[model samples]
Target: QQQVKQSPQSLIVQKGGIPIINCAYENTAFDYFPWYQQFPGKGPALLIAIRPDVSEKKEGRFTISFNKSAKQFSLHIMDSQPGDSATYFCAASNSGYSTLTFGKGTMLLVSP
Candidate 1:
């Protein structure tokens, strides 16, 4: 059903800047929300994630904000660097399901 939708097909920012990527979902059945980062020619890797129980989560310079009621979430990359430039994807999965439905993807460029 393409439950997850992400905005900003592309983004550009300078080093040490913060890039915010937003996403919305339609399925209340989704219990897990994850954001992934992928470099060119590489597979996507989990960057950060949040569950409905938490309003937000943080790992290093990456953070995730989740709203259970609104079925929405977003990712923030703090102090972004050129190495952080990549394609980001937002995804959702049901509680009992292992498969994830992913958003189209947001390409981010961090300029040096």
Candidate 2:
């Protein structure tokens, strides 16, 4: 099975500090990169994503940095808040394929 490895099992940051989560994969066929955020009682939700054609993508306080050649990507939350505390996951898949490989989640705590 394809795998995506994530770093820093957990993280703690100040209210406004940026929390970055990294993920690396080995599959060159994987072209879609997405980040998901999950809260206590809710299922994971798509936060942001980027394609291999782009180097970076930003949406509001969330950003995704992609390195196509390295087959890696990362998610960054800028000006994090207590409400942002949750588990973040990175995933990769080929658009034409039905399989999606996800990395182990990173639990983030944003201090108030």
Candidate 3:
């Protein structure tokens, strides 16, 4: 079973706009939720993360909203710029677990 489900296979936004990506997970054992951003020809890097204990987390222009009871999470990009265009992924993992399952991925395009 796919542990994570992400919505809006892709997105487009103008400069200064906000782009949102959503995700849902099926496994309650998932204790950690993280979002990754990847640019062309580069490896994906951790953008921000959240735990079941926190409802939300923010770092710079990226924010992660999590709902433990609903087993859902979403990422929002504030003041999106063309430079922010990239592929974003949502992932879930349990503490001490070696495996991290990721959502399909969302392609974000920020038009200048």
lDDT of each: 0.94, 0.93, 0.93
Please report, as a residue range, the 10-residue window in candidate 1 with the lowest summed lDDT. 1-10
**lDDT by residue (tens digit), candidate 2, 1-112:** 7889998899999999999999999989999998999999999999998889999999999999998888889998999999999999999999789887899999999999
lDDT of 3 at 53: 90
Clashing pairs in 3: none
Best by TM-score: 2
Name the runs in model 1 displaced over 4 angstroms: none
Candidate 1 on 1-112: residue-level lDDT in tens? Answer: 7478999889999999999999999988898899999999999999988989999999999999998888899999999999999999999999787899999999999999
TM-score of each: 0.96, 0.96, 0.96
The sequence of per-residue lDDT tens digits that candidate 3 reaches over residues 65-90 is: 99888899999999998999999999
Candidate with the greatest lDDT versus the true structure: 1
lDDT of 1: 0.94
User: How far is 64's C-alpha from truth in model 2 (Å)?
Assistant: 0.4
Quote the RMSD, in angstroms, for model 3.
1.0
